[model samples]
Target: MSGVNEDYNAISSVYSQISKLPLMVLERQLVAHALSSCKGQTILDLGGGNGIHARKALELGASSVDVVDISSGMLKDGKTITAASGVNPAMIRWFEGDISSTLAHLPLHKSYDVILVGWTFDHAETEDQLLGMWRNVTTYAATGAKLINTRLAYIPKAEETDGIEKYGFLYPDYKEIPGGISYTYEAFTDPPLRCPATSLTNTLDFDESKSIARQHGFRDYQVVDSEQMDVVKEDPAFWRRFVDQP
Candidate 1:
């Protein structure tokens, strides 16, 4: 199996559970608020793990939802949960691949009215990759479509161990990088082994992300805090907004 698949499989079972934590729940709420005013029928959930947001989108009156995730394991788990929740299996279409490549090959007839990139773009390891993601998402968006992307902002002097234990993970100070964040946890193990996960934050701050969106033919952009559901930044989570230009 590929390394990415291995990593995702390791955490697939617990992914949904962890996602329901207060912070994550707030993140989803913020995403829903961003789309509350959107009366569109087609929605794309990029890197949408376990279909949490996808299910919510359907409840919000979306007629069709497509979920693209890099992990088949995650998608499988999502299918089971969404099915049990009484969501119609036919309303969602699942695609397994990297977000950038998947977006490139989306059916010509497919154009999203709303695109939700929730807490996943931060995995892009390079500036070029991030820019490519912006471009591809814009390419698949219909004119006047709303794109909402949530990213983790760097918090100065942030706690090295806040809320980690509640999710059954560890955040060791020794593992900290100067300008990035790290998370380590063991998935589905008796003696739970630690898996090292880290991402660099220097390349995709809010300003840089907004700039890229504008360059890719998006306009009327704004930022909102998921917790407050407003323009103020009272929390570490925020979502960027863009409307594709005609």
Candidate 2:
């Protein structure tokens, strides 16, 4: 596999593991809360890694969810998790490959009532890349449809030492797991910060990200909710770490 595909494949398993984490539980709740009024609406789970978000949407009674992912490995893992969770297979439609390419190759007949850019936008290499994806989204989304997404703040240039300082935040240090193979993050504030390029893949200021969205015609985004969950808030470094990574 190439770098992009390999990165996704390596994390595909981790993506599945994330669903079991307390942070993921909060993320699910946040999305579900935003989607409470979408019971009968069709949803598009863009970059639906491992289908965890898609499964939750199904549980919330979405009429249907179309899951699009760039990596086939991730989609394959999603199928596994969905099956293990006993989600109704019929509720999900999986599209494998890049979003625009997939759309061009196999077009969806109808617009989505709700489109989820679930941890998706932060990966764009440039503003144009991100905007292009946004244009595609607006093209296929129904009028008044909601697009839920998340991303990290941009990293500052100089005026700082090496490491996470450039990113304006730190990475929460993780304790070695009992087995000593992988690590589990510890609860702490003011831990070590992370690298932005390594974190979000794409770089953009929070204001810049919002500006791009508005430019693409998405309006009425009031950030209805913005509370850090216990696990994330208690450890101030959590969002600066795991979340901003992917």
Candidate 3:
């Protein structure tokens, strides 16, 4: 299992418990916005935990929502979540594998109108990996389809004066791990013991990310929807208009 597997598998039982949390309200909002154009559209949900976003897309009328995840345990929970919601199994296509492997399963020369990566980039092992993920997404998205994702911000050491700024390929502040930029630090702990740390320099800020998308041949790159989120958002009407492609 990859980092995605370990994290989601650990939370499988408690995943739906988020419905009772305060942030669940906002999460639903974000989810709704992310899937607004689902009706008649094809979608890709990468790192779709518990299939919340995928189910929402189906509800909003997406022709299909393909969920690609690395954890079988997490995929199991996703099935439960969708089933509990009465979603038709035909509406969703679940692939239990890493993103790289899942790419091979997608139809060649076929693409989606909307591709979602909610909080997925932070889980990649390297900058090249992140770039590769982006490349894969673009490969499967129809022209002008939107790519939406989020990442945790970067933080600085406690003794440090200024916190690191978020940039392309930087280590995150919420955890400790090797950064994508040329920064050096002693490893005080080992991987698998803690969440992977992200680099402030190597990570993509909003503008830089859009530019990157454009550089990768994505046109009309823009921020369609964004807000502080603590939980899953379920409203498809919120984001469909801005991010949906013709």
CA shift of 142, model 2, Å: 0.6
> Cα RMSDs of all predictions?
6.6, 8.7, 8.5
The local lDDT score (0 to 100) that residue 15 gets in candidate 1 is 76
Candidate 1 segments exceeding 4 Å error: 102-109, 155-204, 226-246
Off by over 4 Å in 2: 100-102, 154-204, 228-246
RMSD of 1: 6.6
Candidate 3: count the clashes.
31
What does the lDDT read for residue 232 in candidate 1?
26
* lDDT tens digits, residue span 105-221, model 1: 655335788888876665665555555666668877989888987765542233644533443434343244555565544332344534444444643366766676787776778
Clashes of each: 0, 3, 31
lDDT tens digits by residue: candidate 3, 1-246 = 246577667656655555443334454666677667669988888777678878888888988888887777778887877877888987888877566444775453378888888656656667666777777787788977877665543233445413221111222343444544322221212221123423433344556666666787767755434333322134444533322320
Residue 190's lDDT within candidate 3 is 24
Q: How close is candidate 2 to the true structure, as a TM-score?
A: 0.71
Better of 1 and 2 by TM-score: 1
Q: What's the lDDT of the predicted structure labeled candidate 1?
A: 0.65
